[model samples]
Target: MRHLLVRLATVLAGVTVLAAPTAASVNLDVAGFGPAHHALAGHGVGYNINGYNWGGYAATGSGFTSVSATWTTPSATCNSRSDLYAPWVGLDGYGSSSVEQTGVATDCSSGRAVNEPWYEMYPAAPVYLSTSSYPVAAGNVIHASVTYAGGSSFTLTLTNQSRGWTYTTTKSLSGARRSSAEVIIESPPGRYPNFGTISFTGSTVNGSSLSSFNPVALDPSNGVYEAHTGALSGGNFSITYQHE
Candidate 1:
């Protein structure tokens, strides 16, 4: 069962699709720690690196010795970077991080599945899609935004791949629209910086439809905002963009 769970976790976490090469270098800093408007504590730059999403985090010890950490995938492409981006210390006040995964598709008929990435957070913060519950069902588009009081404005659009599902409006920074994206059951690899899904109906470079689907797992046990935790907190996150 242990091995089975590991496989399940690997499949659910979407670890198989992170083998692509990255387009740029990821840099993580630890000296300039920022404040916590998002609570949870952790901050830094976030983006895709070498086809794998990474987030860096660093925290000062009570007395001395500070701890700096980088959240990344177990793939060779990500683990073997020389200029690997490290986590950094956050500055005072509010801060934010955002990463985008584009060009997603799936060819189910051929039994070939491509990972469709989505941002997710652990500890499950109750999300609402247009005044409804979480997991904005299919056929609805939700406009999502995040702000850190004194921090920057973070926004993204979510389209439900499924139908008749919606998140509540009260959960949105701008109660007017909910996050929208076509939600698929294909769980992509990588970590969830925040909990949620972004639907994609586009074709890949080879002309394949996006069919990855996931039921949306809310992991509350893991609270530290690591790159793979699907939760966003205070941490240094990196992203190396790629197109193939």
Candidate 2:
């Protein structure tokens, strides 16, 4: 099970975006959840996989210095317990235990849809960046990027292009392997969040389009689960729900 520390607020107008640190961690242990889990993990297009379904590309060695992508938020469905899903791009999380990622979470909680923007550096919890000024919602076109600023420091930026809002943050983290860069869609730990469908476009690594390289699909072994639930086309990646 993955544990999350969420910070959130509802906003309406002009908001000042600030760089802040929130702590959260995901335990990518699929065996603990039993055999029926539907999470899929994929890598390529500069992406990495774990217990969740992911789309993106990863460099061959020592990871990548930066990764970026533009995506449209997907409308999701929920079960009685309300599932959780997030779309993000970041450095690390491929061959290493550390991941620095930021993006939006669209959830079906209590039968209602909840959306929020957030950032996280692994070994810490995720911080929600929703203020009275910068709010995110479904169908928003978002551009997100993560860059290594040398050493243990990194910067993360998110732009809600549809609403003309943006958030940026920089932080220092220790023990990051810097092994891979990724764009991913993930289900936390409780119920599998039925993140309807998410598409990532214009994905790049080290400033080049993902189409310039040979990208691979994530295998089910990486997830310890049975579903290989994503696909890649040109420079885009799409994620779908798992079927029983």
Candidate 3:
């Protein structure tokens, strides 16, 4: 399979407005968690907001004041069956420096729902894969891969503790192209702790592809396992649950 790296640009800016002195200034901040960090590995990630607006506006003691805000959505796609490419943990702090709120997501596409298992049904769950039965040793990374099997693509997820994780576009199987959907998980603070095995669950897309999930017991030999959709060659996806 060919690997690719795509960067979604995130922008942050501030603006001022004129309003009554008694009016309060509102601040906003947005953060996305999940597959968005990696999009070339069939992760199908994206970002968005609903039910509310994000960002802040201020008044400068003017007779009339107005405040406006906007955001950019990452380039992404998901099949009802194939995979999901957005943050399950969504966004927060729409109009305040510090507030607690959930992020929003768009529905999946038609083709992906038919072939991929993750989005086959509505309201999909998070897919997890076990890196090892035990905590991965320091300075070590876990790896894996997936291939197109004559049908629509699928979704895959993994967990790790490396600071920077990425995919390559120069490598892949003979006939299939690397997907623009990918995700990278980073390690926690302090020393790398052993997070148990990674597992996967499936969600259906409304009018897209078919998604399936296979549960695997922990692998003891390589401390790594491959997703059923493809194989792990040369350990392409690698990360150690470690700290800087």
Candidate 4:
């Protein structure tokens, strides 16, 4: 795959808005998560860094060659078209400008829940799978991984174990830094849907437990949109929705 465009983002009133990266850019590309921007929102619990749209633990280190995690896709209760939630495992988005990640996204379409699996080399658009072949539904056991094979080549895999389907791709991105690993639930660019409680198991970086990297907890700090991040246990943790 070829992705050469970048998405520019701005924080206005604590709401992150992704707009054109450059005025001269030609494509009407969708915005994406670039690097992890840290700001301490005092109201958040264990306020390690302001995650903006990220709510999970990120293990930051250098030369992170692999990051993987498994989770059961949560059922999102939707009330509006703007509701969106994505649980993903990725590399570099926690501290670097590039994120090579893949997982499932639950979107509210016409006020109903719609789920699909996708891979992204951000700040590029997410590549939704061949919807016909890569069908994903709620409660599916999804395992995702982004592995640095060598040089500029990386492999991203998203598997739907409950449905017995796997999608894997290898792409070369020249500037990828492979800095940090993450297992995150992101609101992306909309109102986060009610995903109840979702947990991640077997979280690992470079084939080791994610907690071994001194994982930092981020709360996303979005008022009622904030969530409760459970304590990490042997590379496993949970994020329960907290709407107040």
Candidate 5:
């Protein structure tokens, strides 16, 4: 499950792919960090590196200490196939191996969208918050953050503003790179659902606007389902579902 999402690092006019060959492999998430943003069409710097399994913005550099964002939990129009979706914030996994992240998960496994709050220190399976405790529902305002404390210890926090509840935890990941930060809407590594637009505001890295970091936009183009990313303004953006 770790390296399974490493698809399409680069795309050419004729369909080319490149993978981010680094610590990113050991960290399981929706999309592998890959290279940078290049498209198969015009503005082709090298290879197109958007539209993997995630859509939004990723700020790549090094020593990125923290990342946080607030978004509305999207109401998912579920399918019978049990598709899933999530909107979250994290650190690393852009060009590094590990991701320390937290957010809300919407699963359609039961013919209805079931929403829950969760967190993950990659290489480790995600831990969902107690459903009966940290309840999440569509349209609820959610704020999540991942901060690198120091020396392999990091903190993850998820809050449901509408519910007035917050869950915070700190864990250790010895190999984490702390190299990148991102805010994204992604499918959980399998099928997808018709999650409407996810509007993210107050997105930041190190207490500054995420857009100021020159974040690269991702399209969540998996050749099946594709999502669109709205332009970033004051660290605010939206990810919308297009088609499957």
Candidate 6:
């Protein structure tokens, strides 16, 4: 009877793994948003790196089922190179590999500011979804959400509330660690775009506010770029670019 019970448990575990949704593989061309610059002095709830500054819960458990945030589009300056910055919410990729995220990229190309909606599953390049169906612009109120659909599937939704436009897509992902949920301002791996001050309001992970978790300041080992995070109050926070 004991051996039969052990075999049954093993079979159940196998069934659970096989039942998980399988994510479609995507080609990732963009550079990974890993550790870059450092956080600015007196900013950020937790963790600071040279290229990324974020605020959120940093724990290892079942991971976050959903993450969402609302932010006003900030002005961007590329200086000389086509610099880039993004405000995003996602699961994992903080202390582990694999990240599932969606947000708006405010880029400075040829001294002009361009904003658009995009989603990414780490190990794959970001996929831009903005077009005539969902247009984005500066000063628009953007709300982005990433919800886990169990297993390797998740749904990403981005809305330009100011323009009354929304873009949503459901994708399956593989190799997701689901370690942490985050609200971040990132200067992707190549050029350091001047992302002007941006405010993020109503930040939530798994239905709970950011203030509910013990936030930490995450910074890169090498201090190159500089950004700051405002205090978390009422689940709202702001991240400002200090230098790039």
lDDT (10s digit) by residue, model 4, range 1-244: 2231221122122344532233233233545544455544544544445576788889887888999999998887875665666889998876566788888877664468778788888767778776579988878899999999898888999999999998999987778877789998876553577888999999999999988888888766554435767788878999987751
Rank all candidate structures by their TM-score, best first, as comma-separated numbers. Answer: 4, 5, 6, 2, 1, 3
The sequence of per-residue lDDT tens digits that candidate 5 reaches over residues 1-244 is 1132322111111233333344234333344323223334321232124646567889988889999999988778865433666788999877665778888877664568888687877656677778888888888999999998988899999989999999999999898877789998766333457886889999999999998999987776555435778889978988877764
lDDT, each prediction? 0.21, 0.59, 0.18, 0.74, 0.71, 0.62
What is candidate 6's lDDT per residue for 52-98, written digit by digit as tens? 33333342355678888898887677654335557888887665557
| Clash tally for model 3 | 70
lDDT of 1 by residue, 122-209 (tens): 1111121222333322223322222222222222223333433322111112221111111111112332322222222221111111
Clashes of each: 79, 16, 70, 0, 6, 23
Q: Determine the backbone clash count of candidate 1.
A: 79
Q: What RMSD does model 6 have?
A: 13.4
Which residue pairs does candidate 4 place in steric collision? none
lDDT of 3 by residue, 1-244 (tens): 0010111111111112111122253122112221111111222112111101110111112111111111122222231221222212111111212211111122222332111111110111222212232222223232222222233232222122242332211111231222211112211001111322222112111111112111111111111211111222221211221111
TM-score of 1: 0.22
Top candidate, metric TM-score:
4
Instruction: At residue 72, give the lDDT of candidate 6.
Output: 89
Superposed model 6: Cα runs more than 4 Å off: 1-61, 219-222
lDDT tens digits by residue: candidate 2, 1-244: 1233221111101212111122132232211111111233344333334343333344445647888899987666555343555778887765555678888876554456577788887646677675457777778899999998988889999999999998888999897766666676654433334555667898887787765655544422223432343556656877655521
TM-score, each model? 0.22, 0.72, 0.19, 0.85, 0.81, 0.75
- Candidate 1 local distance difference test against the native: 0.21
Model 6's TM-score against the true structure = 0.75
Q: Rank the candidates by lDDT, best first.
A: 4, 5, 6, 2, 1, 3
Which structure among the candidates has the greatest lDDT? 4
